[model samples]
Target: MAKYSDEFKLKVVKEYLTGKIGLKRLAKKYSIPSNTAIRTWVAAYKAYGNNGIKRKRSKEVYSVQFKVEVLHFMKQTGASYQETAIQFKMNNPRLIAKWNQKFLEEGIEGLQEKAKGRPSMSKKSKPTKQEKEMSREEQLERENELLRLEVAYLKKLKAFRENPEAFLGKHKQSLPLNSKKKDSD
Candidate 1:
């Protein structure tokens, strides 16, 4: 499907109104795909004038002032997201949230609608100060505990080495009879 601009639609409508040529001729002259397109344009023009030639209805871009007012109302009234969306006639609560967050982060400049793209992950990935501190403390505690265990193990090993026989008891059942004979000789 081809999209016709308002300007092109107006020109075609004007030509059709002039009655200088038939619909088929006009379609051929303008390289429009079919007579149906020309007829539709003419009908729309006759019914609604120039405004009808524009694109289909779309959401109007909210002005910066409107965004500011909405934010102010939210701050003053402490309204829930649903309540605010209902009041503003906005079906998508997420849109309001996006605007509010943008406004908070970058003021009115953030309210300007941008082309859809990959959403940022910075907010999700960045760690909070409290989390960082807690992790650091936990790591230090683990290291200290490991050191304590290692010291205790080494101390036990040193004590065992000093008195090996005391730790490993002697069982002299097989003391070699030849050693007794040699000692007698």
Candidate 2:
């Protein structure tokens, strides 16, 4: 995939907006992969203007009015977080929580998308040192079990060789069963 700069994207959008060049020619000229990309850029530029060219880590922030509308919906409908999430097409509960908290604290301002970074409160649970040590111990126990089985197998083989009759049981022969004998005088 090629990473076109914001400038390159704007140029393409500008050229497309002029209606002077075919999408194929523009794509070929800029070595863009597909007409689809050019078309999308043009559409975005028309809708959002130059600001659309800048890459956003997240989708466009919900406006204060939009947030208020959602809050109103939540209040009027008495919808739960899940219901609101489904209605608004938002998947993140954290985002919903933030919005709820914001509604309670700063009202509509909290509903605005927070700056993209690590959350103020650490949400990830770290493994304790004891848990890490236990995992290591469990791994060692598995290895020791395998070693014990191997040692037992070797010891059994040695014992069988030392006393073949014990291993073969009653199948042991009394002699070669083919011996020459002299006649008695």
Candidate 3:
């Protein structure tokens, strides 16, 4: 998506507010690909004023349950992604569309947050301040997920230890290559 400066957005919004021209004309004048952009801008501008057109500095993280609720509301009301976002006071409407797509493709689990950035090469780092202040329910949910992972890991470890050859054969993707054969004494 193209990023427009705040000045450009304000200009377009002001022109739109004049009621002299429609969205299509404003879009063509600005050489924008779609008039939908103008419509979105207009809605945001009317709803939030100058702050609406301004770019967000930090990313907002929504809870999985919140995403589910948003999806359900959209489903129940049959509202467009933009409308749903505006109702929820969210700046980015496209994220709701993305969540809907993920939910369709992978069920509720798809809405779960995936780890961002490169995986740690060392020991697990301590939780962030935000995580530290997580609600009791959230903390328990996180702990449950972690415990499930640990149990699965231990089970696989046991299986590998019991019969290395069979376990490696069964789970080839877990290891890139087999170890070289040991020399006989």
Candidate 1: deviation at residue 67, Å? 32
Instruction: Give the TM-score (vs. native) of candidate 1.
Output: 0.31
lDDT string, candidate 3, 40-91, tens digits = 8888888888887887766666766557656755775578998888767776
Q: Which lDDT tens digits does candidate 1 get at residues 49-121?
A: 7754565455556655455545644554577554555455444355678889997898655765576879767
Candidate 1 backbone collisions, by pair? none
User: Candidate 1 regions off by >4 Å?
Assistant: 57-185
| lDDT digits (tens) for residues 1-185 of candidate 2 | 33878788998888887889999999999898898777756655655577645654444345444454445446645776555544554433345656677879974445544567775774658978998999899989966765664465456456556775564342223211211222322
- RMSD to native for every prediction? 36.2, 33.5, 20.0
- In terms of TM-score, the best-performing candidate is 3
Model 2 gets an lDDT of 0.60
Looking at candidate 3, the ten consecutive residues that score lowest on lDDT are: 175-184
From the highest TM-score down, the ranking of the candidates is: 3, 2, 1
| lDDT minimum window of 10 residues, candidate 2 | 171-180
| Candidate 3 Cα deviation (angstroms), residue 23 | 1.3
Q: Give all candidates' CA lDDT scores.
A: 0.62, 0.60, 0.74
